[model samples]
Structures are given as C-alpha cells and as structure tokens.
Target: MVSPISLDALQTLDAIDRRKSFAAAADELFRVPSAVSYTINKLEEDLGVELFDRTRRKAELTPIGRLVLEQGRQILKASEELTALVSQAKDGWEVELRICIDSVLTCEPVYDLIESFQRIQPKTEIRLSEEVLGGSWDALCDDRCDLVIGAEGVSPMPGFSIHSLGEVEFKFAVAVDHPLTELATPLPSSAIQDYPIVIVADSSQHSPARSMGLLDGRSRIVVPTIKHKIEAQCKGLGVGYLPYHRITDALEEGRLALLTLETPRPPEEISVAWRRGNSGKGLKWFVERLQQMTLDPKRGLQSADN
Candidate 1:
C-alpha cells in the first residue's frame, strides 16, 4: 500500500518541480493545468506526504518533494537506457532514430534518404535536429542523437565510428556591388579588417561555442544560420567565406563575386559520426546508406547510393 509509485506520477512531480508552477508544468507536459494538479495531488495522496508549499505564491518543493525529484530524474534516465538496451537486444528496430544534422548541408538531400529508408522499414520514426560546429558532436556525445552528419571533423571524443563525408571548399565572396570587389584582387588582411565579416554562430549547449574565421579585433555580424549569412552577404551587409558548392550558381550568375584572399582559407573537413554500440536497425540502415551516398556535382545534391 505504501511501497512504490507509478513512473507516470513521478514524471508529473518532476515536471512540476522543473516548471515551477502547475500551469507551466501542464504546458510542458501538453496536458491541462487541472490534470497536472490532479496528478500531483494523486501522487501526494499515494505517497502520504505533502510535496509542495501551497502557502507561497510560487510552487516551492517541500523537503520530501526535493528528495523525490533528486531520485526521480535518475529513475527516468535508467528507464530510458533500459528501454534502448532492450530494443537493441530483443528487437532489431528502434522505436525512433534521432539524428543531428549540420546546418551547412541541405536538408533536401537527407530527406531523400529518409524517404527511401521508410519504404523498407516504415516502423522506425525519424527525428532530425540542425546543429552547427561542435553542437553536432555534442548531440551525439550527450546521447541526444544516434548519428551526426556533416560534423566539422573526425569524432573528437573518440569511440565513435567516423567516416569522411568530404571536404567543402570555402571561397571568399561578396555581393557584386560590395566594396570588397572594388578592392584589388587577393585582398589583404589589413584591407579585409575594414569590413564586417558575417558568421554563423555555433549552437552548442553541452559544450563551449566555437567561432570560425573571426579575425582578431575585426567587426563581425553573427547570424544563426548559413542562409542568413548568405542573405547578409548577398546584400553587401558583410564580407566572408561561402562554401563553393553553395555559391556555384550565384558566382556564375554575378549575384556574388569571389574574392581571392592573399592567404587562402582552407576547405572545411567534414565527417559523419555515430556512437559505438548497436544503434538498432533504424540507425544502422542510415549509416550503411549514407556511406554509399556522395554529393553529385552534376545534380547539385547527393545521388542514390553508389
């Protein structure tokens, strides 16, 4: 009678503690505020203890409530790991496959692969997240994703199955009307510093943010994605590097003019990484197909598996 609590009630209690209010917790759990309150009340009724201080304006956890939360999170995590372990050992397919995609790569191509994969294995659900630089790796290392594609380098933390996707050539480019084009070819760093460089901010949460191609003491316009950086550069709002593959048509059509740097910037090396372990059929299906796919220069996207 006074022994164990349901995982559902524990989860509701944890959510209430995290969100700090019944209504807010309801919003997070996608349930009605009354439902959240009822769940908490039922949990307290079963546990034979008061979990919150209703006298205060804010929801303050009682001493016992704090104790429940501290242990509740552990139970939630262990439940997740066990579920994954069982899925791997007993069932070849996973319930879902979470992937972290780098922003520099286009989503259309990856979607193509997803479409193909679903034909053969329609049960596994796929969720995709876009991360920049170290954020992609962080997602995999933090167990947020089963696979990471277009990550900046070979797996930095080790124990990941790393494979080179290919190196992307970076070209110093600006709008046709940009003052940078008026400057002499092979722009020098001193001359370059006069203009603002557009950059994509790294979106790492579990790790420190990474900056790319930021000159010391130079002004920069930091944007959240590659598309924004492209738009800013196309309007002559800033000067910076764009992936050659991305700007090929723009360069040919005169929307962008490639500027030669006195010291050329190196191409960005990219790789696909996944954690070591049986990731189940969904993830394995992705890895095997991704390894065979390559960027098709003629079509301007990844082609069918080679």
Candidate 2:
C-alpha cells in the first residue's frame, strides 16, 4: 500500500512547526512560502486530517501534528545514520568486526579495547567469541573471524600474519588436599600419570587439534574452556598446567597448590593474527592497538571471582 507521507512532506512539516510560520519555514528549507503551504495542504488532504490550527496568526501544530513531528524526527535521524554508514563503507570501514580470543588469555583487556573502539566508531558493530587452543588460528583460516587474539602454535598455512601479544606462563597445579600434592617436589610424569588431567578441548574444526602438558596414558577430563579447567583442577577433579595468570587467586587462597615438574611446561607465546591482504579499518585498528599493549594475564583478571 502507498503511504500518504513523504520525507519532503515531513521535513516541511517539521520546519514550519519549528519556525511557527510558512514564510519562516520556506526560508529555512530554501523553498517558497507557497510551496511549503502546498506541501502541508497536500499532506492533510491525503491523510484526511487537519494538522494545523488556522485560527492563530502563527502556525500552531494540532495534537496529531505534534505526534507526527516527533515520529518524523526519529525517521530523519535514522536516514542520516544510513547516509553516514554508506560514507564509511566507501572509506574502507567494515560494517562489522568479528574477534576470536583464545581461552588461555584474559578477556578483560579485550573488553577494554572494544570499549575504546566504540567511542571512535560507534556505528560499526563488534562481535567477540572464545576459542580454545588451535581454534583461534582456525577461526581466521576459515574466515569465521576477522581477528584472532592469543593464537598459539604454528599457523596452519601461510596466508595469515601475526604479532606477538606476549607469553602466558603455565604452571602445574592441583587442589590443596589432592593426593598429587602429597607426592615429592619436582614430580615426574610417572608419578602423576595415574591421576586424571583436565584438558580444554580444542575448538578447531577444519584444522588439526592440539594438546599441551598431557602425559601418555592418563585419564582425561576434557572441558570446553580454560576457565573450566581451572575450576575442575581446583576441585581435585584433575591435574594439569593452568595459566599462571588465571590461577593466581586460587593459589593465594590455598584452593590450589603448584608443584614443580621434572620437565615443566614452558611459557607459550600468544599473538594477534589476521588474514593477509584483508586490511579493513576495523581489523587494522585492533592489530595496532593490541600490538602496543601488554597481555599480562596476572594483571588482567578475567572476572572478579578469578
């Protein structure tokens, strides 16, 4: 069905209502007074409603006219936003930015980055998702995410570029009262192989899955995220290396105890990665900001409970 209202008609109505006279509205809209009068007359005729009170020398909006003006102002604002979005698209700003963060790192810093980005590009949409182990790199390879943080291990192929975010230190930990804590210091894999080990299931779909700090022939308690692994290990449900930054509170509270291993898990290098040749403004904004900042999990807590 055809609507009686048009954008031009709404603009004329708004100008006349604000200026309080047809001649003044014409001056504001850069149109002749007769044109403004004709527009309001045609709109009232089409809608079959009197939009103005003619008894006064000044144009006074009727109750319905006031409502229409209020609603029309919102439509005008949305149209202006659409025009700005088109302009941004021409300038290489993406309509949306997708970020994939690995579970090994703290998300608080990422949240801070997003908050800062919103202040500059409020029109652009931002999306965030968690990936485990190789899933971060996989997200970029599959084009599921535009940027990946804490992407560890070797790149699956050679098309992605990466910048070091810093390294996450892993420590062997167990619940304070767990049987493994009773074992001698510098515990060897043979001493703890019988205990269940908590592992975060890799999120990779097309890429091969990866694991760390697991010994041969151990009972596995696979969880979906590093946060869960911490909880499981703190409860004595399993034993494994937890990111030193993520488990500091547990260690301080005596919920968990760290043990030395004959061969300790080395610090893993975490990086920010993006596909080569895809240089959207949003992607570059993140890459530049992340490279300049430190990703110390100890200083950046994931949550208050942590």
Candidate 3:
C-alpha cells in the first residue's frame, strides 16, 4: 500500500523551497537544521524519490519535487480556506466570494453592495477583479468568479444566467488635434482605415474572443483596459470608440471629439452573468440585491445617431 503524505512534511517542503536552504527554513520554523534535514529525508524515502539536489550549494528541488511543491502550494491554500469554511458553516456563509467587474464600470455603484454584504456575512471574504469586454464573461464561464458584472449581455454560450444592467453607448471619439477632426461629416470606413485604432485586448480564456467597432484593415494597437484605451486615444496616439458616458465631459470640454461615422455602432446592453446551479447562500443574497440594480440616467444616449 502507498504511504499517505503528511501535511507537516508538505509545510516543511514549502518552507525549504521558499527559504532556498535547509538552515534558513529551520530558522524560520524554529527547528534545528538537522531536524529539518531529517524531515526532508523521511519525506523523500516515503515517496521513493529524490526531492532535492544536494550537489548544488543551495538545495534546489528535483523535477518531481518541483511538481510536488506546485501541488503542495494548492493543497496548502485549500487547507487554510477549509478552516474559514468550517468556521462559517454553522451560519451558512461562503468562505470566499469572487466578483469580476468590467473595466467599463466605475466601482462607486458597487460600494454599497459590498458594505451590505459585509454587514450580513462578516466572515465571507470578497474579491474583486476588473476585466474588459469578454474578459468578465470568460471569468464566470471559467469558474474564476462566482458572479461577473458588466459582461456582454449577449453571448453564444449557453448555461449562464444573465441579468441585464443597462445599455452602454459607444462614441467614435478622437483627440481634438487628430486629423479625423478635419474630415468632413460622415467619416467613411475607407478613410478611417488609414488611421490606427486602439483596442482593449480581451482577457477571455475559454470563450472565443469577440470584437466591436474595428474595421477590416485598420492598423490596431491593443491595450489591457478601457482606461488605457482612453488614455491612448486622448494622447492623439490613435483613434477608436469609447463609452459616451465615460467621455461626455471630455467631449463637451473639447478634449475628445466625437466622430460621426457613416456607419454608426449600436449600444451594448451589458449584464451580470453566473452559472445556474448550487449557488451558496451568500451568492443568493447578493444576486437578489443585484436584481434591483439600476442604471445611471446620465448614460447620455440610448443609441448613436448616424
């Protein structure tokens, strides 16, 4: 029969890997260097493998030891979380909840929800992730998030529960000093293609990526977030569409000019997406509050004018 791995041995391995030396790990753990070495040898003998390269000045993990260390880190994380889960079990609270927000959204709207959640379940840990475009949807689909807010409301994937947020308007905006400002009304696709467009790279992992407002042959510069895209456009580095609500003040102040395209883009109806089954009580409570969520009336336009 195979021997079962001990959690103490795993911790010792991690301490050694992290410290890069048995002497240092022993110091950190308040044990003698010999005791630490004994633990390592015992673990290796139990697993029937060499765990460290003693030939090196600093002990380095063997190939299989590196793999075990990686898996051990995951187990260590799960074990720590198990304590929190058990502590909250009597009250039906989640040990952790991950929320992914779209970069297009301002966090001000969710502050109240967070405050309320903390009041209701003080023990539940909350994490927030900011993603652009399909990244939010991909987070929920890939199990990285319990709920994703401001994902594209429409997607090809099935098995998700989508709750509408509101329609977000897109404006073809450029810096006031750009050549596009000199272009006559109704900028054609052909002329627009000559200028480079800045786009946010999708952070999706599993879902097939999607694109919006991009032309067939336009030169493109990709950025990580909506804020970065806006920054790129505002510096006259490139041109592209931005949310009208986000750029309204800039447009009115003449910092960014709205381009009247020959082909107008439609508003995106954004929403929250999460998987449908076995949601924890904490998740259920949050979803009820999100259902009553409202959009800002100052979102500017319902649709872009052609």
Candidate 4:
C-alpha cells in the first residue's frame, strides 16, 4: 500500500500552485527558496512522479501536478471546514459562517453590527470575503458564500432570496483643494463637464446622469475599483462619484469636498441575499444579527431602520 501523503508536502504543493514561483511560494510560506525546492523534490521522490516543470523561471505544474494541486486545495478547504465543525461540536449551538460583501457597503455601519454579533456569538466562526458590487451576488448564486451584502438594484436570480437592509446616499465629491470645491454655488452641468472626471467601470451605463447630458463629456477616465476611484479623487485626479457615508470622514477632515450638484442622485437600497432552500441555523443567526445591527438607532442614516 502507498504510504499516506505528508501534510507538509501538500501545503508546499498548494503554495507553489498559488504563488506560481518557488521564490514567491517560499516568501509566503516563510521558507528559503532552496528549502521550498527541496520539499517539492522530496515529495516528488516519495510519490515517484514528477510534479512540476522547472524549465521556466516560474514553475509550471505538470499534468499530474495540476490534478494533485486541485485536490490539494479541496483537501485544505475541507480540512479547515472539518476543524471548524469539530470546534462547533465541542462548543454546542455554534457553527462556522462565511459571508461575501460588496465593496460599496464597506463604509456602512454594518461592520459594527457584525462585530457585535461576533461578540454575542463567541463560539461561532465567521469569515468575510469582499468583492466588487455585483460579484457578491454571483458568489451567493454559485454557493460560494452563505450570504451576500450588496445594492438592491441587482436582480435576484431564481432560487435566491433578498432582504432589504437600508438605503445609501451617493454624491459627487472631489479633493478639498480641487477647483470645483471653490465654487460658491452649485456648478452648472456645462461647467462641471469642463474638468476631468472619473467614473466607475460601466458607470456611464448604470448612471443616467453620466450619459443624459447632465455632465458634459469634455474629458473622462474609467476606473475599476471603488477604492481606486476614491484614491483618484483624493489625489485630485478627477471628480468622482462616491457614497456620501464613505466620504464623510474625508470631507470632515478636509481631504475631500462634496460638490453640490443642481441635480441630486437618488438613494439606492442595500440588501443581504442568499440562495433559497439553503437556509440553516448558521445563516439564520447571521441574517438576524445583520438586521439587528443595521437597525440600531445610533448608526444614523446608515441604519436600515432609518
């Protein structure tokens, strides 16, 4: 019979697959480059098969290596799940939960609510994954996450359920020293269009104001991430749109200034969603906690109750 595979070898293979280079893998695993190479070499010797092609600077997985790596990732994930399950069993009435969140809602008071929930359910294991707005909904549909926090405009797929958390206000903002911030009155749409503007990816299609002649298209830049959009605005790269709550601190600190517009953008609803027929104790507790935290009176306009 073949001897059992060593966990260390499996970990080395997994790191190599993810990092795609011995040096990169070694850096992540905190091992020397030669040590990483030696581990893989020993694993290959024990398995009696070559696992990687080292012809290139970055190691390429051999056919067997690809198969082993795929299985290794699953094994690792399953091992983590198993450990969580054992811990939950010992603690009683507690379970591990994984959730996905949209980046736009990251500024909301919901984070405090989550922390409070964690405090209340100390035995429960919670993990959060953040992605771009619509990506969280995709993760929920794909069964990759137990719940998704995102904007309400996203259409619910079949076999999915959604719960409204609250509404968020968006506004156009720029750096405090930006020329637009010097205006005593709301700038005309024509004048606003004269400066460089940054829009989120596909934002022109999503926001009518962008294409409806609200802002003249004199100059434009499109960015992918919300954080990048904020950074671009903060750096005086361009006037970008952002959630009002997200920019509140920056506005208060004089890092950014809100530009009053003649036409105001409408508020958008935020929601938490999950697949139907998959609800369980863990999901129930999480959803309940989310609702409670968002409904808290002290959270101001970000609260769902507001």
Candidate 5:
C-alpha cells in the first residue's frame, strides 16, 4: 500500500521545525507563507496527527512530531546520498570532496592546488579542515574525511593508501631574551629542566594523543596550533622544538634563537593519504599530484608543476 506521506510534506515539516515559523520556512523554501502552512495542514490531515501544538504561539513539535522529524532527517540524508551516488556513477567525479589538512603544514600550497583543481571540476564542492598530528589519519579512518594531507604518526592501516611527502626537520628554539638563550650550546638537560616548555595539543579524537619535545617535571604551556606554539615561545613563555621551516622569519628577525640539544628531535615523515576503494576523480587527482612531490621544509610542496 502507498503511504500517505510525501517527501515534499516531510521537507516542509523539517523546514518549519528548523526555521521556527511558517513565514521563515516559506522564505527558505522560496514559497509564500500560505503555501508553507497549507503543506503542513495537508500533511496533518493525511496522517491524522497534529504535528505542531497549535495552542502555543510559536510552532513547536509534539512528541510524535519530534519522532517524525528525527526519522525524517535520516530519510532526507539517504535520499541526498542516493542522488549523489547516481550522479557520481554517471560522471567520474563526486558531488563533494572533504579534505583534512595537518596543522603542521601551511595551507597556502593546498589552496593553490585547489584553485587548479576547480578549473576542471568547478561544480564539485571542496571542503577543507585542519587536524593536528594523528588527527589527520583519524579523520580518514573514521570516514570523516575523504583525503588527508601531511598525515603523520600512524602507519597505513588496512583501508587507506599513503605516500610520503618527505621529512620536516625540527629545531630547538627559545626567545632571544629567554633564560635558555644565555645558556651554553648543547644545553644540558639539567639547565633546560628549570624552564617552561611550550607544546601544541594533539587534536586526535579516537586515537591516543601524541606530543613532542615535552620534558618530565617541566612547566608546560599548551596551545592549539603550531603557529600559537611559535608565538608563545617568541614571547619567552616557554621553550620547545619547532619545525625549522615555520620559524625562518623569527630567527632572522632576532626574535627567536636556536639551541643545540643533546637529544634532538628526529625529523618527522609526513604523507598524503586517502581511503582506499574511493573511485572519485577528485581524490585520484590529488593523490596523483601529491605523490609526485615532496613537502619542502622551507618551500612547502615542491615539484615541477608547482
């Protein structure tokens, strides 16, 4: 038997529930308020359920109405996915592509690549978000993103493919006026232990959070991004190892000074990664382009195409 509910009515219900008024829903749906009201009224008549408590001044969903709205959103989401899947099947590209970028790397080069990609596939939407450390890999593993750039720490799991973007070297640095700056080269751990250390907090949600250059019993100042860590160190708030590429200006301007450490941080190997079995042209385009290049510490993504 055919159900009395229609997709259009469900959409109107959702719009009203979200927009909070018939007039607002009408504006969103590009229809007159009467049309929006009529749709809801007709749906109520067919279903024999009052979706809203009309006695209230503001449009509010009843308990049954809330249940319907909750279920209706899932239906709408599935419908959208089916439509996009059909479109993707026809063309080799996807309707949208989401990319997660590691916070250690600058986004300028990635933006340049995006500009190049849009020349061919302008209709496809590109979404970019920044993740720190293992968060990039976590985003891909959890299906939160289709592709990741500069993913580090975790090795390739069973579902995704990865290609090296090369290693980023780190340098032990402190503000020029910091107490550590006055110490001898190859500063002893005992001398450094008294000062505070700055660090970027890991952004991973599912995996264990990772940190670098942290010392036991040392005062720590934690910030959200590498840029912030750099700023904090420059202000004489703390001392830590920072990516050499990101601090050239600070060093040249005499804002921060590098120190030799007995135990230096090893260079980190970063990579471009994407979930396997994704046939979308956007992901393939980036994977191919990124695999040919290496992440230059001073120059960002380095290749002939760049």
Candidate 6:
C-alpha cells in the first residue's frame, strides 16, 4: 500500500525548498528547525526513501525528493484551486480575485476596468499586487496569484496560457533641464551613450529598443523600482527610458521631456496570463473585466504614440 503523506510534511518540504535552509523554513512555517527535520524524517520513513541529502549546508533534494516535491507542488496547487472553487460556490454571489502586475503603466487600464466591474459586481473583491519583471511569473507559478500582467518577452510557464492585451510604447526621456532634451534634432545613438542612463534593474530584458540594437553598452544607474527610476531621472542622475504612458502627466507639466532618438524603438507587447485548466470564477470574471476595459473608448489608446 502507498503511504499517506501529511499536508504538514508537504508544506514543510515546500517551505524548505523555497527558503533554502531548514532554519529559515522553520521560521516561515512557525516551527523549530528540529521539528521541521522531524517532519521530513517521518515523511521519508513512510516513503522508504530519503528526501534530502544533508551533506550540503542547505537542504539538497535527492532524485526521489525532486519527484516528490514536483508532485507535492501539483497537489498543493490543486488543493488551492479546489478551495477557491468551493469558496466561490458557497458564496457564488461574491468573489475575490488576486492578481500580480509587472508594470505600473498597465495598471491604468486595469484600474479603470476594476472600477467598472465593482459597480456591476459590488460583492466581488479585487486585490492587486505589483512587482518588477519576473516576480509576476513567480507569483503565478507558485499559485500565490490568480493572474499576471507582463510585457511580451516573458516566457510562459508549462501550465499557463498567455493572452496578448496590446503593446506598451517606450520613449527615451530626461529631466526638463537635461542636455539631451536641448538638442534641436534627434540625438544619434552614439551621442546619447555619452550621457549616464538611469534604468530599472530588470527592465532591460523587455526593452524594445535594446532588443533592436538601439541601445548599446553604456554607463547606467540602476534603480530597483519604476517609481525610483522616475525619481532618479527627475533628479538628473541620468537619462531614463520608460513606457511613455507612465510619464504622461510629467511630460504635460514639463517636469520631464521626451528625447527623440535617431531610431524609434518598437513597442513591447502587453499580455495577461493565468495557469491553464484554472476554472475559478473570480479568475474568469477578473480576466473578462480586464478585456472589456481594454476595449472601452474612455480608457483611450493602450499605448502612447511618440
């Protein structure tokens, strides 16, 4: 007979894998390190195999441990889905949706959509979370979030489906008094490189300009968040590149100026993604609302034209 694996053991294993240390996992799981060790030991005894190789400072998964971990993750995800379904059924008239968005620019349309959705479905609760770059993908993969909004270059995970929403146009921008903005004509790529550039830490991968060879290796100041990138630019630390829509107010108020480059960068695609086979009503409703909002005329064009 196959041995039964306890949920506590499975969770402990997951926590250990995620935290990389038994003690850290213990802190997260609210148990002592020895307790976590005991749980794993019990699980291994039941399975008649060792799960982790203890030779390393951190818990290293054995071959069988890897298989068990993969299966455990699937089981946990399914359980969460099941729980969501049950919650939806019991409270069919109300829903709660959780989503993680990678870019702040995409939030404008989504926020408008949520406002409209709440008016129609007042009982539904919506939770929005934002993270930089790959964090959205990580949240979705870990089953911590229901949906993810990201730029084009993000690779879809094995069990997820991606839908193209539209594109986000990027512009080379600088503080109002920055030298690049004083140029009468579009600055050549080589000339632009002479100025220190401020860039979001993980945003280079999604940069349409960089992908097309418009931007070369140049001196750059890196900031951790979109807000910080804009702040860094405004402080005149360096010229910055960002989605045009994100700086519309600043541009209109003359706080920032968009610098015309010799070559225009292509737009990065915007996409909404969710795990495949996910049938949670809240997830379905949230995605539908987002799509509807995108088509609303009052929401305006999805991307800014330079």
Identify the leading candidate in terms of TM-score: 2
Residue ranges of candidate 5 with Cα displaced over 4 Å: 1-89
Evaluate residue 86 in candidate 2 and report its C-alpha lDDT on the 0 to 100 scale. 95
109 Cα displacement, candidate 3 (Å): 1.4
Q: By descending TM-score, how would the candidates be arranged?
A: 2, 5, 1, 3, 4, 6
lDDT of all predictions: 0.80, 0.86, 0.81, 0.70, 0.85, 0.71
**What's the residue-level lDDT of 225 in candidate 5?**
85
TM-scores, one per candidate: 0.68, 0.81, 0.67, 0.60, 0.71, 0.58
Any runs in candidate 1 off by more than 4 Å, and if so which? Answer: 1-90, 295-301, 304-306
How well is each residue in 93-147 modelled by candidate 1, as lDDT tens digits? 8767898889777788789889998898665778999988888988988889989
Cα-based lDDT at residue 163, candidate 2: 83
Query: Please, what are the lDDT tens digits per residue for candidate 4 over residues 207-261?
Result: 3212111246478766665777788889888885687766676777888887777
Error of 2 at 3 (Å): 4.4
lDDT of 3 at 47: 87
Candidate 6 vs. true structure, TM-score: 0.58
- Model 3 local distance difference test score: 0.81
lDDT of 6 by residue, 60-102 (tens): 8999999999999998888887787566668653366787877
lDDT of 4: 0.70
Candidate 1 matches the true fold with a TM-score of 0.68
Stretches of candidate 3 off by over 4 Å are 1-84, 297-306
Candidate 6: list runs displaced more than 4 Å. 1-96, 104-108, 115-125, 203-218, 295-306
TM-score-wise, the better of 4 and 6 is 4
Better of 3 and 5 by TM-score: 5
Candidate 5 lDDT score at position 54: 93
Clashing pairs in 3: none
Q: Write the per-residue lDDT of candidate 5 for residues 51-166, one digit (tens) a residue.
A: 99999999999998898889988888888878877776578897889999888888887887899999988768899999888788878888899999988755536777889898
